[model samples]
Target chain A: MSGSRLSRRTFQRLAAGTALAAPFVRGAHAAGKISIGFWDHWVPGANKATTDLCNEWAAKEKVEVQIDYITSQGNKNRLTIAAEAQARAGHDIMAMPSWEPHDKAKLMEPLDDLMEPLIKANGAVNPTVEYLGKADGHWLVVPATAGSQIKGPCSRIDLLKEHAGVDIQALYPAGSPPKADAWTMDAYLKAAQACHKAGFPFGVGVGGTPDSVDTAGAIFSAFGAVLVDAKGNITVKSDTVRQALDYYKQLMAVLPPDVPAWDDASNNKWLISGKGAAIMNPPSAWAVAKRDAPKIAEQLWTHGAPIGPKGRFAPFVPYFWGVWNFGRNKSAAKSLLLHLSQASAAEKMVAASGGYDLPAFEKLTLFKTWVEEGPPKGTLYHYPNPYNHQVLSMAGAPAPPKIAVQIYTQAIMTKMAVRHFQGEAMEKTLAWAASELEGFMRT
Target chain B: MADIAVSRAGTVNGAGGRTSLHRLMQRKSTVAFLMALPLITVIVLLVVYPAIYSLHLATLNKSMERFVGFGNFTFLFGRETFWLVVKQSCIFAITAVVFKALIGFVVAHFVHNIPSKGQRKWRGMLLVPWVIPPAMSTLAWLWLFDPSYSAFNWILALFGIDPVPWTGDAYWARFSVILVNIWIGAPFFMIMYLAALKSVPEQLYEAAAIDGATWWQRIWYVTLPMMRNIIAITTLFSLIVTFANFDIVRVLTAGGPLDHTHVFATWAFRVGIEGGDIPLGASVSLFMVPILAVAAWFILRDITKRGNEA
Candidate 1:
C-alpha cells in the first residue's frame, strides 16, 4: 500500500472511530433547533412575556427557538396535541392542559430530573398538579405558568352588598387573610336568589362546558360528593352527592334560565355586560371589563370561594409543558423549560397575564402581581389563595384519571344537576348518574 | 378461392384489433383515466383511506393497542346519551331539510316570477346566507341568540314580550340549531330549484292554461312532474350534508343543556377528540354512514325510475 493510503487494518479502525463520533457530531448540529407550542393566553400581551423569556434563553444558549401560541378556542390546541401525538411529530415542547399530561403520559419524556430540583427551589407542588403531571410514578411534564387559573368567585362588590347583603369585602379583605367563616354555601344561595330577584342573575352556568364543569366540581368537592371514588368505585348514590344536587337545583333556579346552554364565554360576557352580580372565573373577565367597561371593572373583586359543609374547594386547572420523547432536541427543550420554571420567569409570566395565570408551586403563588393588580387596589390579593385557606382542586379528581377524565369531558356532574333541576326526581337523577358512571368505568 | 378470401379478411380483422389493443395509451378511455388520476389519488388518500382507517380504529381499544372488535359499538348501544344523539341527529336532518326545501321552493317560484332583469339582483341577494361561511354566520346567530346581550331579545323587549330562551331550553336549543341550518341552506336550494324551474319549458304552462287548468293545478300536475328529479337529487345532497353537520350545533349548544341537543357529529367530537377515546369517537362517527347510505340509495332509485319513465 502507498504511504498516502492507509493500510486495511488502520482504515477499519478509523472508520469505526468516525462512526462512533457521528452521533455526537449530529447532536452538536441539531442542538440549535427547538420548537414549542404554548397555550395562547387570554390576557393581552401575555404571549409577549412567554416569547421574550424563550428568546432570552435562546440567545444565551445560542439555540434557534420557534414558538407557536396555540389557542384553546374550539379545542384547536387539543386537536393539535392529538395530531402530533398520533404522528409522533411536532414541537419539541408542547403545552398540556390539566387532563392532557395524564392522557399522553406514555409518549412524554420523563422529567423527574428536571422537576425535582425545581420543586426544591419553588416549594411543594400542588396536589392537583402532582396528580395530573405525574404518571406511573414519574413526572411527565414541567408545570407551566401559562393558562393555569383558579375559578373563584369574582363578584360585583356593590351588587353583592346592596341586594344580597353580603359584605364580600369584609369576608375577603384586601391584603389580609380571608375571614370567610360566614361565607357558607347557604349564604351563597341566598345571595344568588336576591340577585336574581333584582334582575341581575348570578350568571352561574349549569351547561356542559369547562366553566360550568369547574364550578360544579368545586361545589361538589365542597359538599364531599365523589361520584366516582379514587378506587374507581361508583359513589354517585351517596348522601353528599344528593346534597350537592339539591343545592345546585336551588342555585340554577336563581340563575338565568339559559344557564344550561351557556358556554365558557357566556359568563365572561355576563360579568362584562353588567348583567350578572358574580361569576366563578379567573381574572380574564375583569381584565376585559377593565378595557371595555371600566365601571364594571372598578366594582369587581376577586375573592375566595364559599365554604361548604365539607370544606372550601377552589377550582384550579394547571397547564403543563411536556417534551416529546421523539423530539430531535430534547435537551434544549428541557433546558428551556427549566429556565421558564424559575421564580423570576414565572413571576414575569404571572404579571404579564394580569394575575390571571396561577403558578402551580406553593411558594410562587405569593407574587406581588396578584397583590397589586386592580382598579380597586389589591382586588386580586385573595385571587391566589394568599393565606392558603382554601383547598385547590381540579374537577373530576380523586378518581382514577382514566375515569375522571371521561367524567370531566362528558360534563356528567353538570348534566346530572341540570336533569334534576329540570324536574327529574332526585332518585332518578342519581340513578342516571350511577348508570353513566358505570359506563365510564366499563370503557 | 372463396375460402382463402375469407381467411385473409379474418386475419386482417384480428391484426387490426391487436394493433388497437397495443395502443391503449392513445385510447379515449385511457386518456380520461389519466386526466382523472389526480382526483382519484386525492379521494383515496383523503377520503377512502381515512374512512377505512377509522373503521380499523373503531375495532381497537381506547389506547389503540389491542383490538376489541365490536366492543365500542356495543358500549355505545347501551348508553342513554348515544340513543339521545341518534334521535336528535335524525330529527335535525329530516326537519331542517324538509323546511329548507319548502322555503326554497316558494322563494324560487317567487324569484322566477320576477322580471328577468331584476331576477339576477334578487337571486344574488338571496344567496348571501349561503355565501357566508357557516362558522362565521353561526357566530353571528350565536350573538343574536345570546342569553344576556341578545339583539333579538332587546328588540323583543321593546314590544313588551319576554326574552325567548333561544338556546337555553332543550326544545329551543334544538329549534335554534335547526333554524340556523335552514337559514344557511335554504339559499342553495333556492338557486338549485330556480335553475330547475328555468329548465321546465314555458310551453307546458301555456298549454295547461289553454286547457283551462288553474295556476295551482298547473303547478301540481305539470311543474311537480318536471322538477321531481332535480328536487330528489338536491334533497339527497342536502340530507347528507345536514346529517353530518358539526359547526352549527357545536357552536350553538355543544350538545348541552343536559345533552338534549347532542347530535352524532358533536357527540362524536366530544367523545373522540375532547374525551381522548379515539375508538369510541370513531364508533360514534361510523353510525352516520348507514343512515346516509340508505338515504342515497332510495333517492337514486327514484331518480332512475323517473328516467326510465321519461
Candidate 2:
C-alpha cells in the first residue's frame, strides 16, 4: 500500500475508536464520581468485598463512585502494575499493599488534611500509619486494615510437652503466653534438635522462598539483624548476619530434613497433620488447623518469637495503605480509607477474611479471637516484638522485597550450606556467600 | 535503423498496456487487503509492537532510565547465579527432551502393538498426566514432596532408607523438576510420534519381517528415519518450552532451598520482575533468545536435511 493511503486509514480508525470511547468517558465524568482502578486482591474479601461495600456506602452518600476494578494475577504483580499506573495518569484511588509504599510514593498524593480529621474523630488509629503515609508532613495514604502482631508459636504443644519432655510454662514464666521471644537462639535450636532427636520434625524456614524468608526474618530480627535498615541502606554485612548464619547452621540439623526443599506453605500442611512439631509461624495457620486438624488448632497459640540474647526483635508486616495520588476519586478513596480505618469496619473485614486482617490499632478493636483463629497465620509463629521492632522499628521498611535478603543469604552467602547438604563443597559455601552478599549489596 | 526504432516503440506500447492491466489487478487486490485490515491491525498493535517493545526493554538498563547496549548481558555475566542458570537450562532442556522422546517412543510402540480397538483406552489412560493442569497436578507432586508426609519417602522408607528431599538439595530439586516435566510432556511427544509411526507404511514392516530382518534393525532403519522429522520438531518445541519454563519451577521450589534450583526463567523473574529491576530482568530474559535460537536453528537444519534426502 502507498504510504499516504495507509496513513489515511490509520487516522480513520483512530478517529473511530476515540469516538466510541468518548461517550462512556463523558457519561462517567457527568456522574461526579471518580473512576478508580484497582485489583480485587488487595483489600478484605480480597478487595472485591470492600469495593462492593464501598459502592453500597456510595449509594447512601451524595456522590457516587465509579469503580474500575482489575483482578490481579497475584499481589506483587498487582502492586507493580498499580505502581506503574500511579506513576502515570491511570488510577486515582488505589487500594494497595504498603509493602513497597516508599518505592511507589512518586505517584501518590499526600493526605495530611484527610487523615488528621479521621484520626482525631476515631481514637486508636495506628500512629505509624501517619509516619509511613506521610511525605513532607502530608499524607499520601491513610491507614487500612493490616496484619496484626497477635501471632504465636503454632508449635505442636502436645508433641513438645509429651515427646521433647519440655515444659512450655517453665520456658517463659514471664510473658502472658509462654513467650517464644524470650527463648534464646541456642535454646530454640536445642528444642528443635531435641524434638528431632525424639522423632519430631522441626520447622524453620531455610528455604529462600517467601515463607523461608519470613521465618528467617522473624528469627533474625530477634537476633537484632536488619537486612536493610529503615533508611533504605544495605546493612547485612555485620555480626548480626554472622550470628544468624551460625545459628541457622546449628538449627538446620533439627529442621525437618525436607525443610531445605520446603516451599513457603509446606510446613502448614505438615504441622497441622502432626508431621512437624514446632513451626516458627503465625496464627494464620490455625484456619487450616481448625478445619483439617481441629484438635491441633485448639492447641495452637500465638506468642512473640524468641528474643535473641542480643535483642528483642520481631518481623512485623504492616499492610499499610497508600492512596494513589493518581486515582480518579480522591474524596471517595479517602472516604473508603476512613471507613475501613474505623474500628468497626476493620473488625468486620477481619472476621470476613477468616481473621486474616489484624487490627492496625490496638486501642480500638478487640482482636483476641482473630489472633487465635485464622488459616495460614495460626500454624505459624509470631513474635510480639514484630510490633516493636519490625513494625515499630520498620525492619521491613527497606525499599525492596525481602527476596534480596534471601538471595544474599542462601544463594551466595550460604552456598556452602546448600552444597554441603547436597554433598558438595561446604567450606566454599561460606566464602561464596560472603562474596555473593558483597556483589548483591553492591547493586 | 528507422524500421528498428518504429518496432521498438511498438513493443514498448504493448508492454505498457499489459502493465496497466496488472495495475488494475493491483487495484482489485486492495479489497483483499481491506478484508484482512483488522487482522493486520491487531497483529501489529498487540503482537509485533509488544515484541518490539520488549526488545526495546531488553536493551535498556535496570531503571529503564538509560540505554545501555547489551549492558544487561554484561551484568548477567557478572552474576554467579546466571552461570548456574545457564548450566541448569542446558541440563533441563537436554534431559527433559531426551526423556520425553524415549518415554514417548516406548509408549507409542506399546500402544501401536495393542489391538487397534484397545489402543483408544490405552491412549486415553496415557494422556492423564498431560491432560491434567500442571498447576493442579503439581499440587499432588507438591504433596508427595512433603518433608514428613512424602509418599516418595514413604516408599523409600519401606525399602529401609531415609526420605529424600525430592525438591530439596540442588541435584534432587533439579531431578524432581525434570521428572515432572517429563511426566507432563511425554504424552504430547507420544501422540506426535504415534502419528508419525502410523504414517510409516505397513508394507515396509512386512518387507523387513519377510526377510527375517531383526526388530532392532527394522526400528533403526525404518521407524527412526521415518519419525526423524516429527521427533526433531517435537524435541525442539519441548526444548523451547522447558528452557523457558516458569510455572513448574515457580510452583515447586520457586528457585529455592537456595538459588540452587533457579532456572533461567525464575532467575530472570527474580532479577527483573520481583526485584523491580526491569532492566536487569530484561537482560536475563533476553539471554534466553540466543539459546532458543540455536536449538531452533539446529532443528530447522535437521528438518531441511530430511526434506532434501526425501
Query: What interface RMSD does each of the candidate structures achieve?
Result: 1.4, 3.6
lDDT of each: 0.90, 0.64
Task: For candidate 1, write residues B66-110 as lDDT tens digits.
Answer: 999999999999998899999999999999999999999999999
Highest-scoring model, DockQ: 1
Give the range of the ten consecutive residues with the poorest summed lDDT in model 1 chain A: A23-32
Instruction: Supply the DockQ value of model 2.
Output: 0.32
lDDT of 1: 0.90
Each model's chain A TM-score: 0.92, 0.73
What residue pairs are clashing in model 1? none
lDDT of 2 by residue, A1-443 (tens): 57556587799999999999975663423546655544443333545555656666666554566666555343453555534652576555655544445445666777776667766765544444544555666666666554443333556667778766755545543223343343666666777888888887777656665555556655655666655554555565667666666677777867766667665476777777776788755555666678778887766654545657555444444555556665666666677667657766765666565655565554543344444443334322233322333333232334243334335324332333444455544345445654554444423
lDDT of 2 by residue, B1-310 (tens): 3212233334455567675554444453555677899999999999788667768887875446678877777767886778988988888888998999999999999898899988999999999999998987877887787655778889899999977878776678888888888999999999999889999999999999998999899999889988888888998898898898887877777787666667888887776555556556666777888889998998999799879988
Q: Count the backbone clashes (under 3 Å) in each candidate.
A: 0, 45
Candidate 2: stretches off by over 4 Å: A1-31, A34-57, A66-91, A114-140, A146-152, A161-182, A226-237, A362-431, A438-443, B1-46, B206-212
TM-score of every candidate? 0.93, 0.80
